[model samples]
Target: MSRTPPARFTRPRIALLAAGALVAGAAGTAAAANPDTRENAAAAPGCTVDYKVQNQWDTGFTTAVTVTNTGDPAGSWQVEWSFAGNQKITQGWNTQISQSGTAVTAKNVSYNGSLGTGASASFGFNASYSGTNAIPTVFKLNGVTCTTGPGGPGGPTDPPDPTDPPAGARVDNPYQGAKVYVNPEWAAKARSEPGGSRIAGQPTGVWLDRIAAINGVNGGMGLRAHLDEALRQKSDGELVVQLVVYNLPGRDCAALASNGELGPTEIDRYKTAYIDPIAEILADEKYSGLRIVTTVEIDSLPNLVTNTGGRPTATPQCDTMKANGNYVKGVGYALNKLGDVPNVYNYVDAGHHGWIGWDDNFGPSADLFKQAATAEGATVNDVHGFITNTANYSALKEDHFKVTDTVAGKSVRESKWVDWNRYVDELSFAQAFRDKLVSVGFDSGIGMLIDTSRNGWGGTARPTQPGPTTNVDTYVNGGRYDRRIHVGNWCNQSGAGLGERPQTAPASGIDAYVWVKPPGESDGASKEIPNDEGKGFDRMCDPTYEGNPRNGFNMSGALPNAPLSGHWFSAQFQELMKNAYPPLP
Candidate 1:
């Protein structure tokens, strides 16, 4: 609803012509209309014009100017705004309108020509003005005056309902008995675990709770720390410590050209950022009962544009932490830390099967993510399987927007940009990913984490809420439930219902979900839009795939300072925090 000024004038003669017509028909209509209708009409001789302006939030405005149809036909009118003062219009739209030194005018749009007595057609403009004054009154619509609509920024109202609600919301879950995971800060300074709920962070059993398991032995800080917290506060082991991780160096496939040849110190940076963390986790004795994971985002490495084949494209590209990249070296590095990384499962993203129906692109992305995880040192237990439809996965289960379309091809468009399909058939595609993992020698304990974040009705389409409900039982583990994926609004604005973890995956293998990214923080935008080509809006954008895709780019106010501060992101996180763990019971 970001409105720009009218692109030139769609028409400038509307008001003038209608003004003359009104003068001619004024007397005639005065005698013809019903007595009551005329009685209620303005009891004036000359037309009184009321002009106003506004810019409504999210949607455009309706410059409702009551064009008193002082004539007949109820059509043809010209509206003009002569900026008598220094006021100016920056931009506008929706009419054959034009402007001169001070006047901005709008003619009746071609389709509808007339406005009978009392009838009026509303037209408006989204403009930027200067000096402290509204438009002058000399401007008229067909010389006939009219009443104005409410004026102000989008007409004196609260801002549009942003995606997130500022104060924490009561997103009461429909699934009462399910396990769930709250954010990191909530886990850190917990007063106590709620009754009947198990903590999902670290299981006190063996791998994750004690300081040794997470710190001394297995060293990674982000998730290992989160896992540990989940374990320490579990009152009844009922809390489903959900976490999500989509760490793509560059959202696209062509992130790194020649690891050794390109940058000055890629490997060292990789170890410091990605590898060293996994190494830390390996040496921990507390690696036993935690739901930690190394999820591989398919087609998610922003830099790997040409590397589109499958696991092979991602497999060979090693994360030479010994060098200087800021991420953990590829799977090989993590694998080197095995034994200690136990119970930590991995999920390769299977770009939703919606792509399968389109061209089978996502499957390979999933395969590559797994391949990379395996290369990094993740085992069958740590990197068990894959998941799809995470955030805008082009899946059919769009619980958010009810993704259906007028396009006759499939139920929806492939995607707004790429030709890849966006609608995923959850059951069929889940089975596909499951079968793929199973076929890949993953016999006993392997399954996929169907990102239930955007799923709703199975078919057709409608306004689906209840955010995203999961179905772990039907697809895997006789339904014991495992990890699932979802979003908590990286920008951290309020309204996004984040902590409602599903109650399905309650076993050892199918680990609980985790929020890998610090919500409110950005993964980065892709190199698509003008300001965003070549480089990423964030590190997680996979133009060819779901690089933690953004539903829309909402530039609220000023930008944040750095990647660390993530100003907006933090604000949103604070809002989410307020919601998930409000002060009251």
Candidate 2:
């Protein structure tokens, strides 16, 4: 039984009420506050600090702080401040943060250490406070007091140099103001098909799914080749190159369609042979200008939550992977090594809502992610964000209905389709899961990416309005856009279509709408075929096979005559373009 579904898949405020000039204190200290939550303080004579309380609740708050270097360029930087109240930071991202009583120190991690003159680096933290959450009155950048008064050193007149790239510093969102790399290889394949030219130029993830992929697999583009092509595509400005960092030991434990080459205990080989080489290539200075976004280890960790132990969907392979601890260790090792590359942004693969949206799987999945992040010397900071629905066909949104909707006086979740899941679609699940992650110690600033590659269930069958209020099943079945017999039917889904075109900041907490799973690529073979890539023939990929507990015991719903996973499937491609939502022009 294959458990695979689709494809892989602060507040604060503290203000002194006035916008007043900074009051200089002894030893070159200066402090100023605005009517809003933002406060500026001078750190030494070379840096300025802007601290803003982003959100606040009864006992906790989140803050974003930016430090700008005003003096000579430095290879590294640090920002220090002291809280007036008994505030303790619970977790932080993008920097190493430590609190000594009320005093706090935030130091740049490996990737963001370089601070060019007039360059700024930002980091944020979530903290707990009792009573007042007063804004810090002073800030020190690299031990220098930051001054922001009129005509003062490091003041408003001398702003950060807009043209200067902060060496290896990361942007808030890598996709914003950037052109994503279009894989000429995948594009060529797409152009070969009739009308494929329409989406041939669109960006899709370069999947480094196996060790052979590190170098060219069967003379295909290697890691360096892709980066070089990205550089060519990027004439100037920023360019985001998406890489799918898969190939974990015991990979895709719950499914045979995408099984990996490595044995269950090959943690050392995964780190040394797989992640290490990729990290080395990414760290190379030649590729530093390109913003490399890596979707790390798809379909690995989530199995530990939903398909392990005594769960109805549990597999012996999943149980073995969970017991061996290679999944957590491998993910941690990957996050740690890949994160060291300054321009590389690591987004862990969070399974889509259909697989883990239930009450039992959601929280445990987040908790397991934290465990992986903290294991093998990896920290939450290594994860820049998370990507959901990497290769599966989960609808980006359900416009006609929601999980909260009550059809015939019963919640829509009770429907066989929803099956008591907390979320009805990918967007809601991603947002809510992000919140859950933060509450469990991820950085508050973390963003999410949704793979809209094949989720759009458009076509003649797409529902334009809500279903009749006859019953919950009819309401959900009639109005739903996803045509899958069950959400768990993930292998080369018959009605799946190209979702939203890749775009930046599509929604709150979403970094971008990505196509990580390139369209036309088969999820797995419809029948068992011999291959050296370690992929296997799973029954879920067979159109005639009955389903398992993971998919509610329905028909597999997979398309027939599919090739092996990752191979191009022309029939599936044409169908996707035909049914594309927002209909392809």
- Model number with the top lDDT: 2
Q: Which lDDT tens digits does candidate 2 get at residues 1-585?
A: 111111110221112111111111111224332212334633324666767554454566556566767766789888888989999998676689999998899999887788876676767666778898888867887787764466443356667756444545677667755667889999999989997876776789999999989999988999999999989878765678999999999899988999989999999999899988998999899988988899999989999998988989999999999999999999998888887777778899999999999999999999999999888878887887899999989998898998889977899989999989999999999999989999999888788999999998999999999888899999999999998999888888888889876655656788888889999999999999999999999999999999999888999989999999999999999999999985664
Top candidate on TM-score is 2
Q: What's the lDDT for all of these models?
A: 0.35, 0.81
lDDT at 541 for candidate 1? 36
Off by over 4 Å in 2: 1-167
lDDT of 2: 0.81
531, model 1: CA deviation in Å?
Answer: 18
lDDT of 1: 0.35
lDDT of 1 at 544: 34
| Model 2: lowest-lDDT 10 consecutive positions | 16-25
The Cα RMSD in angstroms, rounded to one decimal, for candidate 1 relative to the true structure is: 23.4
